[model samples]
Target: MTSFKIPSAPRSIQKDNPIKFLLDSETIDCLAHNIALVHPVFDAQAFKRLALTNIAPLGIMDRSAHIAAALKATLPAKFSEAADILLQTLTPPNVHTDRLGLSVFFYLPHTRFIADYGRDAQHNSGEDPFDVAMRAQYELTRRFTAEFSIRPFLTHDFERTLNQLQQWLNDPDPHVRRLCSEGSRPRLPWGARIPQLIADPSPVLPILEALKNDPSLYVRRSVANHLGDIAKDHSTLAFEVCERWLTDADKDLKWVIRHAVRHPAKQGNATALAIRKAAGGR
Candidate 1:
């Protein structure tokens, strides 16, 4: 079987500005076109105007924030109504097999908007909006990703949110399975740190156990990253997990274990060193 390599972000995007790549005029036009297909009542021109207004002065993060706020303001006032509109507008999952395809970039802002709205509502209402948020995230991830979006739930309601993530372990879609680990990482980049997990990552062991040998490399990579996050604060725990999983492991599983202990291995931690030795320093 031949694998298709997904191209990296354009050099212009990488060197100039990531925000421009995401919210550029071309992306907005694609978004408008797709949205109009699902929503006859949608005002594409108005939506574009709102999203692009004053967007020039902002930096990368601020641009994303501005777009989220703009989405909420222009779309239906009702949360459910607005969420439904966005969900319907999502491009088909099969349309973009490449993880970093243009379609994913186009949908990124919309996913973030859903996440921000859900998080605010959950925080203010003091209610677990896990179901609603998870459902939206599950769908949104198929198009782009909800990794950063799901962090609020994990922060506010760790146990409940974790239980929901555990259920996602069996999801047929590799993205959903990946989310189980990625969304729960203690130190995910560009995401809020989860103090509880950083202090004691034992709660997430079950999740890691389930995905340690995931068929999808995408999912397995997340498991490794989640473990690496754990190692930052709990090196012993990370080392122990790696040691246990290293014995009689295959190449793929060993890759995961190595990634899990990368930080500790660099620092000459005994157990990390031993695990690397066991894997023959591959």
Candidate 2:
């Protein structure tokens, strides 16, 4: 696994940039260590041995604000370039496989980075003569989908970046196909809570439906999550989706139910609790 190293942003491009203030390796290590203490026996070395980062001990809640701050600070001067570096850096060497916690930490930040960069490129002068926003989105997504299989993080901007990602999704890349599902999730853990998707989720329905029987297991997991998010706000819709999915008796769908319902169930939502009881789910 390669060590992820984003090129350091120079001061000239964006002076007194917040990003420059936040890209501190000492800070990241300190935060990572602090969170790692949550699990007494969690060994950081062994966890990083398998070409990934560990999420069990550190969940997203503790680190999200810090990571978001770091990434946000970077946007003014090096957004486009910094985004490229961050995505490249999040791969195996830079992170562990326990992606749920990791996604919460990085995905939301990444999405915001993309959005901020788009805004910056659109507004900033001397960026590029040829539509920097379009180019930046294109380059960012193109490189991102290649290394990471997480779509939920990448596709939070379907309306803005869909044109950029559509070709890749339609391409031979299975990763991109997986992304189509992962990126549209409504309640994707630490990822942005897509309010529209949580309420309606219709915008991404076609994408998930197309991926219901995807060849890749990785891709299929996203379909289940997309459906599960719907279950959070619209139980009726989730029930319908589960009804269809249960016909196939997929263990993965069960996993989605358990994960997606955990929060609502804990909150004592009557509908979720009833569904859990009826399904004999704990």
**Which candidate ranks first by TM-score, i.e. highest?**
1
Q: Candidate 1 lDDT (Cα, whole model)?
A: 0.75
For model 2, the local distance difference test gives 0.48
Worst 10 residues of 2 by lDDT: 94-103
TM-score of 1: 0.86
Where does candidate 2 stray beyond 4 Å? 1-24, 27-112, 120-158, 162-178, 246-282
**Model 2 lDDT per residue over 1-282, tens place:** 323333333423355443323324433443234334443333434323321223224333333334544444433354555444444444332122223221222233344444544443343444641234444333333333322223322444446444444444654545557656666676766455656666577666667666766666666767766676787678777666654554554565555555555556788877667555544577
What are the per-residue Cα lDDT tens digits for candidate 1 across 244-280?
8887899999888877787788888888877877866
Angstrom error at residue 117, model 1: 0.8
